[model samples]
Target: MTRVLLIGALLAAVFWVFSIVDCALQPPIRHRGVSKPVWIIIVVVFPVVGGILWFAVGRARASALAARRAPDDDPEFLDRLGSTSDQDERIRRLEEELALLDAEDDDPRWRRPVPPPAASQSTAPGDPADKPADRPGDGDDDARDQRGAAGA
Candidate 1:
């Protein structure tokens, strides 16, 4: 008998703790009869009875859960979105800016062609552009002259 009573008391204590934690942790919007703090106080003050009351009265109803909807489905949420024409105008402006940028990248005026060196311009002997063929009496030319003479 004493063991039964002890077990009952232990169960009641666990229930009271669970109720208090549940009430405290619940969002203010989920509380029904009173505010969250009040629910927690009720559970703390009344123990088993307070826990039962918190579960029965303070908690929000299951049907109320249906009020929540995805932002895309909610009328208030959809109302906040502006007209499609306004979005289209923004998109059109963005596309025009992108086209303008691409045009700038491709424009010949933006990138001038590097002109080839004039035929009249003199090059130094050590210049990288001064090839052996460009110089008179080069070894290759002498060799070609020898070969031509031998062939003749």
Candidate 2:
């Protein structure tokens, strides 16, 4: 009898620790009843009772296998199960599009759009509009240009 009581006390302590850890790990949004902090306090203060309450009221229910309702309660899961026909239609449409693209590829004359030839105004090596010939000694030209602009 004394051994059984000791084992029971040990089990209760283990259960209390497990419940407290699980409750602490659960995010506030996932907690159902009171709040995560309150649940933790409850579990710490009362071991067996708090663990039972946590399982009963504090844990969040999974959408796929939540506690009680009719089979049709989850319409999204039902829709997923019923999507074979929609998937077949989608695959057919994609195959048709691929065939059209392959036909276009087979014809050498049906080529992708080409950009128009670049204008010749810029003689610089890189992109003409982006970089200019200005360098270390270019400040003289800029000062002259600014002076000219101010005068104008």
lDDT of model 2 at position 21 = 92
Which residue pairs in model 2 clash with each other? none
Q: Give the Å error, residue 19, model 2.
A: 0.2
- Give the candidate number with the greatest lDDT: 1
lDDT of 1: 0.82
Q: Which portions of model 2 show Cα errors greater than 4 Å?
A: 64-152
- Residue 112 in candidate 2 has what lDDT? 79
Clashes of each: 0, 0
Angstrom error of the Cα, residue 61, model 1: value is 3.7
Q: In model 2, which range of ten residues has the least summed lDDT?
A: 143-152
Candidate 1: segments with Cα more than 4 A from true spot: 70-152
